[model samples]
Target: MKRGVEEIVPGTPPKSEEEVIEARASFRKQYRFPPENNNLTAAQTRKVRLIYEIDITLSEQIDALSQLAKLNLAIRNILPPETWESVASIPDLSSQQVSLKVLDSLYAVRNNLSRSGELARRETRRTDRNLDLATRSYERAEKQRMDFEDRTGAEDSNSSIVTDRETAALASQAAEEKLALRRLQSRLAQAELALVDNKIERFQPFLADHRLRVIFSPEHVQEQIGAFSAKEADLEKSLLASQEQFDQLTPNAPVSTGLVAAEVTPGETVRQLAQSYGRDAAHARVSLNQSWINHLNIQRQFYGHRVDFYQNKIKRRQMSEITRELDLEIQRLESETDYLRNRMAQARQDAVRIGDQFAGTTGISPQLIQSLQDAAQEIVETLRMEALSTESTLSRLRNFNDELLNRTSGYTWHEIQAILGDRLPLAWNYQLFILNDRAFRVSTLFWVVFLVVIGFFFARYISRTAGSLLTSKAHLAPGVSAAYEKLVLYLLVVVICILIFNLFNFSLTSLTVVSGVLALAVGFGSQEVLKNFISGIILLIERPVHKGDLIEMDGRILKVESIGLRSTQVLDFDNSQKIVPNSLLLENVITNWTLSDNILRSTIPVGVAYGSPTRKTAEVLLEATRSTEGVLASPEPFALFSDFGDSALGFTIYFWTNTADRLKISSEARHRIAEALATENIAISFPQHDVHLDSLNPIRVELSRQS
Candidate 1:
């Protein structure tokens, strides 16, 4: 099955033995590889396929290595040193080395152009493929239309045929437009590539000459100043042209062409146009303002660079001539920035004029004014983002320049900072809100924060003062005073919140959504809590049980300690604090001893021996009750002989006292009654019992001792 190399490979036949040997050697060089075999076994086919796969992989590896080499060369030609800090010792040499930094930027631009070109090429191929497919589809549609035209059909069928023909024609038109768009894109890519090439061709020569002058002859650097000045002049001219364009430009209102005046009312049409006009004008105005700010910052940076460059030249004569043109370049930047500032102001005025056009016009709708305000708000938000970005860029630039100045100059850090405008006021005047053309700025944020902090203390003070008045002057119950204080505090807090919302131009109506969410939450899970809160409010208002009032609930005696919104605090008989839900008090049957008054009636019972002196026992009981502390003398103590028992005559006494001290009064009364009964020889009795045994159990009484 083995074939000669000349048979397997497509090449001239080897005429001599040496040539055959060379061919065989080359074939075997690919290690187990076989050339194309049209008629071969399965094993030879596998070997050929494997050889093809290896060829593709090797080709890709070679391409990757070539790209890597190109990148390495670029780095070597344009990259700065790995250690920038160490370069400060040899400033001239370092500047001369990094003088090609401009070339790096140029190379980046070229790389972008190349990537764009590659994409354009891919788009071209894809569009060409699509065009081919579309052409085939159009041909198919046309053939269908012609066949339908040749057929004899009903009237309805003829209409369908006409429709089919129109569809075919439309498809053809679309294909033509697609091809045209592709051609235009290809031309655009070519033009961009040419522009990049031209810039490189023009700038690279100048860079090379400047580098040579810095390296070989530093004295002839003054001659190159004229060339740099000419370049600056060119840049100035370009800046002027751009400013002119910016000034002349007006953003067209984005009104839809489909909005027909006949379809809508005259007012509606005007409203739509007004909305678009206001938005467009506002966008233009914000854009101009942002550009002006950016230009101002750039001018400041140029001024710093210029001063640094001049200071370096004054301090050291050995500065590299390559960077000498940087001073003129910075001057040019400053001049261009000034020009931008003037033109941006003009553009801003024009935008204002457009935005205010409806102000003096008759029959202006309120909706139009509202739309203008809304557009201004949108631009305010956009400006906020732009301002933050500009602020970050300025800070980074300042830091970088400050560090560079520190490393390369004899100036102190503070001096460098001052030179970089570190002492300039911050952007606190930047508008954060635009309400009907009125601005609320970053300074307003400070006011809001101040108000919030001070409002907290102020609310507390007012609540405390109100609480004192309710407790002292009004003689209100403690729980009621606390409730009123809380209400006052919350009212103050709400007022402060409203003021804060007003500062941001937020309507309280917006809280309806928040209220809805809260209502949903309450309906789902807080029914019992809400019930308790309402019950607490009822308790405070109706004064059902005041603080220090004794009450018995669910067989336990408790004193009301404090009433709150959700629950009430009480002290049990054991003096332990307990939290009871307000709903429990309202729902459960509770006995309030001091609901009407604190006076409570308590009863004491006594038994005297065997009817010897029942009247005396009653007298003794009455005397003890009258002598007891906290017993109300106005509701005088009363005693009576009630029931006759087997051992003694039972007597009862009743007394009135403060409900809170009832238990203590009863205890003290019992002690006094016992002492008085003993003094009167009226013996208090105990239970007596008599037993009878009918059997002979009492006859024999014996005692036995166990061993």
Candidate 2:
């Protein structure tokens, strides 16, 4: 093949001065006021100036009249005089030929009129401001022209300067005239707007007079029902169409590599093919997103219309049978609306997943990926708007239903039951499917959360009440009461979990599979937690180191406050609470102060001088134990001469007390012993040592006295 050569093109030449001038003149001729012709003689310039002034004035008038005509037509179309007159003349809607549809039309007309009036007033104000500025400019220009004429009289020689002043004055005058015309147009629009409003005002009182009658009329109610039903059907059809389109739109398929290899493919050709494929794929995705957004919007409109239809049905609930039917419809609508909300959420998620999968593929540039993301963002915004619209419509319907329910007392228990069921589906009867082959709903999840929260508090209250009853009525030990309470709570939790699983319709086989997977995960990643959990179960069953037991661990005395599944809470002597893991408590050595009984023997060691009366000191120690509070009386406090030291005799006081305050008891015993020893004139010993000097020579003793 011969090599191909690139073609080169020559650039265009620049325009000549005369051509440039002609182009500029043509452009200026298109505008309202063409630029001044400097080449003209003084007479021609004066004639052209006069003709331009007259043309501007005529154009201004034409524009003003055209604007006023358009405004009048718009107001007339928005609210026809016949419709307004018919509404105004009819005092009783039931007696007149007007239907609810006609009233609704009038309502729309009033809204349009109000909006038009407001917009007209705003335009009038804007025109007034512009006219003020234009009037000032014209006055200034005219004054300057007059001053120039006064200084240089009619016989002045400088005709050019005088011409310039006259031209300035004419231009300013033209601007003033245009603004004056705009002001007139704005005034005429306001006048027309007020006429429509006055017509609407006449109907306003009639509307108020027949408001209740219009609302309760069976014919009008049926009309609303039919209209809403038709709207819903139309939206449903459109939604189905959009969904079909979205489903049919698939991403561009990849080119066959075998076919490409069989053909003689150039690198540039392959690149172009790849680029086209990527662009087609991206475009397909954007179209799919747009289609899906349209589908969601239509689906949302259907939901809103259905809700409105059901709410409108409530107005005709005069009979018991009809009221019951209306209630069922309301419940069905609520459930359907909830289902739609969840489906929309799932659809949004699916769209995102599709975009993510596309983004991960090769042969796609960053720009293509960014474009896909932007499309997805637009889809999100569309969905958000649809949701807001649905919410607003549904909120109004719900409020209206609630107000009707409150105002009427004809509703039976079935109606109340239906309303409550609609408001709160706590019975878990409503089934909303999220995933195919499995029925799940956002409302179900919400109910689960609500029930769990309420159940949690309820369980806590029941457990505490049971614990109190076991402690007070049955006279059970605190540890036993706590263990029973915890067992009750855990059982309740297990029951809640089972109920939740049942709500999901999970089979035993599925739960077993899930359990096996969780067990494997626990064995690998949660050994400590598993160990602690099992240890806690053992502790709860075995009742070791239970609540209200005073125990010493890690050289610190602590009181057991509560026992939990994975950890035990204990209060230290310093009044701070600490959490000790169940496994740690099981493995570490702990000293239980009151394991079998609340009473425990505590000893206090005291030393006295090689004394005159050791027996007296013993009696005093025993009396001290008797005097101190929280010291048990049945065990019989006693003192023993336990040991002898180099300078004093060691005495120990032994006593039994149920009180966990060992520090307070011991301190009190020591104080009593010292006071009694002092009162009996028995000396307490301090550390004393005797020193001996041994030397071969005679030892000399010297005593020094200070004056």
Candidate 3:
């Protein structure tokens, strides 16, 4: 080897100066190696080598630790911190092995921040837009407020004007009232003056009569005296005529000569001749005289003796005179009586005539004269009042006519009269007469046409309306339609019969009264039946119940099968039909199932064994309810463990169904529950009895011994 410029030292090798420089350069180079080189000694590097090794190892650990820290941070970001410990303890490579993990996390964070920022910006923009819209709305509202204020001001002004108009109207009314009051006062004063004038005029006749009271006299006594003297002269003339007739009759009677001869013989006494004459005469005369005297005596005795005769004659004469006077008095009395009787008869006739006259004139009795007089007086007063009123009206009319004439000054009264005269005849004979004739013809035609038209319309209306009503499903219940139709036909026929009778001018009023009385009798006799009849009519009119309805009455639910006039038939839930009186139905309270639209609710209760998990049982029941056919789903089924029982839990499962056949649905639900219970091995308990025999052998022995 070539000896280099080396200085040998004790226990040390020496190198040339160039070698040292190179070694130094190499050391420097090694020390100055790039960060990627990692060329360091394991030792003899001032522990820098160990330190470097350690640092290298530590760098890996540090990287791993840093990655774990980052992973912890990432986990903290992804999940809650409390979850980190549990997750970190899991056997897996730390985050250091995971390349790009931090980068991904950073990117995720950045993206999230960016999205959040964008959302914030959009929200800010939306807020600004809303603020702008609110500002515009406020402006519009302000404009509306201003417009409302203007309208309010105008309304106030209009109101003020209206108030002023009302005030002016009130003032005008007050002024008119004052003027009317003045006019009334003036009219009262004028009426008072007129009344005074009328009273003064009425008293004028009385005053004139009083002035002429002393100028009256009487003159009638001379006529009475002359009439009495004429009566006395006629009486004297009749008496003289009676005396002259009596003298003439007395001169014509026969003479008596024996009385004179007897007077001459009594003075002379010629003895013998006188004696002989006397004897002869006496004998002859005595014989004749005796017979005559006897006859006369007998006659006188038959009549009475001479003195007694004279007395009797005097008595008879006196009696005749008395009788004649009595006759005269009786005749006078009879004449007076006759006169009185004739006067009474005349008076009675006059009274009868007066009654007849009263009857003929006023068709009433004379006893009602006071009432008649009062009526006449009232009529007279009324007439006087009417006359006064007519005069007033005439005055008013005259004033009105004068005012009209003065105002117009065009037509003269003669011109008016001429115009009236010219129009009167034409109006009376031509226009009015022709119109009357035409009206009579029109009225006849109208009555004829109206009767015909109304009859036809009434017939048709009755037929159609009754037919429609009887045929309607609602009116004619299920089984009674035929009967109702017959009833309707009968009613129509009866109505037609009545109408025909009316057409013939029969007195339907009397007939109707009789019919009403008959109806009353029938109604009283059959109140329940008549009530049913009336109730049927009310049912038809009011339509409270109809066919095919479900109703509950008298604690029985049934379907309406037939509604007859007398009775309503119903098919009960048991499928048996029953007939009920219409009156009874109407009079009693009833529940109509279909009245509130055919909706019904049905409830079913169930129980499950206790200690079988109440929640689980409820869930099962709800499931069963939901699965049941015909159960409503939108409302959902619910189950409730209502109570705990001794051996089971009481539960209620509620569901809804719209099936028309409720019985079938209920049966099916029960079957389904039974099947489900069987499949789930669930026990269903029943009321039961258990018996025990403590000593079967003793009982058997005792039975054997008894046998």
Which of the numbered candidates is closest to the native, going by highest TM-score? Answer: 2
Greater-lDDT candidate between 1 and 2: 2
Model 1: per-residue Cα lDDT over 1-707, one tens digit each: 21222232234421333443454355347444546678955544554554554444343333433443343343234323223232323334434433322332333343444556576556546655665665675567556655655673434455545555444443444444334333333333333333334434444454344333323233333444454456456656655654554556555546553434456654565576666655554554556454545545554444444335433432333332323444444455455445545654554554465456545555667767666556555544444444444443443343334334433556545455665574334556767866444576778777878888899789989998999999999997675677677667767988997888787776767668778999999999999999998897788777777777788998888888877779989998887999999999889898998777779888888888885676666777887889888888988889988888887788889889877667888899999999998998878899998797788555877899999
Worst window of 10 by summed lDDT in candidate 3: 1-10
- Clashing residue pairs in all predictions, respectively, total 0, 0, 0
Q: Could you tell me the lDDT of residue 7 within candidate 3?
A: 15
lDDT of 2 by residue, 1-707 (tens): 11111111123322333543454354346543564677987754864675476455555565555555565455445453445554455444445444444454455555566667688678657766766776776678667767767776777667676576556555555655555555555455455555555556655655444333433356665665676567657656655665565556554446542234535433433444444444543444444444444444444444344334334543334434433544655565466457546755864684576455554555566665555555555555554545544444444344334434543646545567777877666545456653435666666677778888888888889999999999999998888899989988888888887886677676566556668999999989999998999888888888877789989898988899988899999998889999999998889898888778887889988888885588888887788778988788888888899888887898988998765576788788778778877888888888898999888999788999999
The C-alpha stretches of model 1 lying farther than 4 A from their native spots are 1-460, 470-487, 490-500, 573-575, 642-648, 659-661, 694-707
Q: Candidate 3, residues 599-694: lDDT per residue as tens digits?
A: 544556776665566776667667776677877776676777787666666877776655256567666766766666666766554544458868
Candidate 2: list runs displaced more than 4 Å: 1-436, 700-707
Local accuracy by lDDT, each model? 0.59, 0.63, 0.46
